[model samples]
Every structure is written in C-alpha cells, then in structure tokens.
Target: MIDHLRDMGLGVDPVCRVLDLSPSTYFARKTRPKSARRLRDEELIPLVTAMWEDSGRTYGARRITRALVRSGRQVARCTVERLMRELGIEGVIRGQRRRTTIPEPAAPRPPGLVNRRFSAERPNQLWLADLTYIRTWTGRVYVAFVLDAYSRRIVG
Candidate 1:
C-alpha cells in the first residue's frame, strides 16, 4: 500500500506518518528477508498439495498428518490443517445421516380420532395417548403414557 502511494507522488515518510507508522520501521520491513517459517511453509505447500491430491481429496488433516509421518516426514497435524485450509481443500465426509421419521406419502393416512378436541364430560370420558423417546446415559428410553382429558391427570 505504501509503495502504491509512493508511486502516485506521495512520499513514504508522509504516508507512514498519516498511517501512524514509522518511516524507518516501514523501510526496514520492506528490506527484511522472509522468515524461516515462511520459507519452510513455501517448501511444504507443494508437498501438502500433492499428498492431498493423492488421497483423492478424501483425507483430512489428521489422516494427512499420519500419511506424512509414515512417509518419514516430520510435520504437525495442525500445520497440515492450516496448509490444507490455505489451499482451499478438504476431505469428503462419507456417511449416511440418521433419519428417525420417513413418512410414506403413498400409504393410507389414519383419521384424526380425537377430531382436535380434548374436552370431556367425565373423568374417564376422554383419554389421550402419546409415545416418545428420551436419550439417556445408557441409550434411548421410550416412554408411553395416557392422560385423562377431563381431570388433566396422567392415568398411566
């Protein structure tokens, strides 16, 4: 940015001052050599890209790190992850999603037995039954109950 401004007749010193940057610091940054980590990253970019492509793009960071280590390459999983993100590549997640309800459109439908009404003249006149499940530490616990509509009480 400073270079662009300098090219457009603005002095580096004045631009640095307006941007709250010291001119000397800006000049030093421009002259400074690339850091060791940056150079290493540049070297590793191609290797990571090749490894990712070799896996048919189905290997994520963890798997990629393992493959690199098996091939005698000392690289961290996080590094591979970062490189993969920079390369804009990711693994394909293979699995079927669990579906609890799969309604059949062609099947005959059951009538609304209660007709959306819950009132009753007596205690046992109207009862509503419902079934549901709850996930617990062990597994899913299915629960079924009957409620007396007139008294608004759980009968079972």
Candidate 2:
C-alpha cells in the first residue's frame, strides 16, 4: 500500500506520518520476511475459494471450517471467516422470517362498526380513535388520539 501511494506521487514520510507510522518502521516492515500466519493464509486462500465455489456459494464460514476439518485440514472458524470476507463470498439465507405480531385466534375481536368508512358528513358526526406507542430513552410511551373525520384534524 505504501509503495502504491509512493507511485501516486505521495512521499513516504508524509504517508507514514498520516498513517501514524515511522518511516524507519515502515522501511523495516517492508523488508521483513513473511510470517508463518501470513504464509498459511496465502496457502488457504485458494482452498477457501474452491470450497466456497464447490458449495454453490452457499456455505458460510462455520460450515466451511467444518468441511475443512472433516477433510483432515486443521483450520479455525475465525480464519475461515476472515478469508471469506476477503474473498467477498457469503452464504444465502433461506426461508421466511417468523412474524412476531400474529393475532390471537381465540381472542375476542371488535366488530367493524364503521364498515371501513372514514368520511363523515359533518364535524363531530364521526370520530376515529387510534392507539400507538413510541420508544424513548426512558421507556415506551403509549399515545391515544381521536380524529374528527369530517375535518381530518386531531381532536385529542
């Protein structure tokens, strides 16, 4: 990355300063040998990509790690997750999410007395009442409101 920046006309010292790194440290790291972990990651990148593709691109990190273990390869789930993130691959989530607001079948229900009619011939002839709740820092606050149908204004 530093080399790329340098090629783009940015000086090494300024770039290192912006990255909170010393030029000497950057130079030392640039010449340092690849660590074991980095080498292992390089070797595993292709295997992870192949596994992901073989699964029709529907296996997440946990499943990929399990598959690798089953195949006699020792690898951590976190490592597989990181590799998958770098590869820009992910599993597809299937099925519909469960609804949390299902109405009770046994509960008594109110009759539709207004027959879905909201308009009124005159003010005060018909009023609509609704209950709603809001979440706040303190807690949930419940609010009830009454609306004049003819005027279409909040009465309470």
Candidate 3:
C-alpha cells in the first residue's frame, strides 16, 4: 500500500495517516539503514556460489569456507552455510547397505566336510569351504572357495 501511494507521488506521511499508522513508524522503516553484516552477506553470497560450483558442487559449506579462506577470501563458516541454503545447494548423502546373501535349500550339502577335525595328516586330506558376499560398482557378488587344512592350499 505504501508503494502504491508512492507510485502516485504521495509522501509516506500522508500514506501512513490514511492507513491508520503513525508517520514516525512508517518513516523509520522506510529510512532504516542496512547493517554491515547484512551487506557483507549479500556481497559474499555470489562468491560462495562461485566457489561451490567450482568445486563441482561436491563440497559442503565447511569445505567451501576453507577453500575460500585458502584462496585469500576471508568469510565465516556460518556465512557459507547461509549462502548455500539460500542457493539451494547441498552435499551428497550416502545410501545405506543392502543385504545380498540368499541361502539355498538344495545346494547339495557336502557332508561334515571338516568333521570338526581341522587337522590333516597330509596336504589335501581335509578341505573346508565357505561362501561370502562382496560389493562392487556393478552390484553385489557372491564368492565361494575351498581350502586344504594341511597345506593351506585353496583347493577350489
């Protein structure tokens, strides 16, 4: 409403009076000065944005602030955080682990392979086998192997 009145060339005092507000309050708000901190934030926002993009948008506020300081540009960590929030920039979040093991009922159980007797008289007398899971860039992979108790050689 104040802007509309000003558009018609009317002074703020008259506008405030018509709007049932004190002219002093309206004038004080209209002539209010911005603090140095606010001005610095406004100025630093672009710098922070540039640094964030330059880092391939992978760095969070803490790292971006450190990079800025290292580059001779002084700024606060909190300031970087605020700027990142305003620019809608965020760090990547890692996902949780997924279970990949699946037991088979008819996988053919090789009798008490070790028979609780881990010792072997000769090289490949007793063998033990086990299965485990591993994660790779492609996906989860299962690995099974057999080892000889005596010579400790991987039979399979």
Clashes of 1: 0
Off by over 4 Å in 3: 1-23, 95-156
TM-score of each: 0.55, 0.56, 0.47
* Candidate 2 structure quality by residue, lDDT tens digits, 71-131: 8999999999898888888887865554435899999999998999999998999999998
Candidate 2 differs from the real structure by a C-alpha RMSD in angstroms, to one decimal, of 13.7
- Please write out the lDDT profile of model 3 over residues 1-156, one tens digit for every residue: 797889999988788887899988877877899889879888888788887788787889888889889989888898888888888997655666676656799798767745688888998777888788788888778999899989887889
- C-alpha RMSD of candidate 1: 8.7
Assess the local accuracy of residue 72 in candidate 3 as a C-alpha lDDT between 0 and 100: 92
lDDT of 1 by residue, 1-156 (tens): 999999999999999999999999998999999998888789888888888899887888888889889989899988988988998999888665556568999999989988999899999999999888887667678899999999998999
- All candidates: CA RMSD (Å): 8.7, 13.7, 14.2
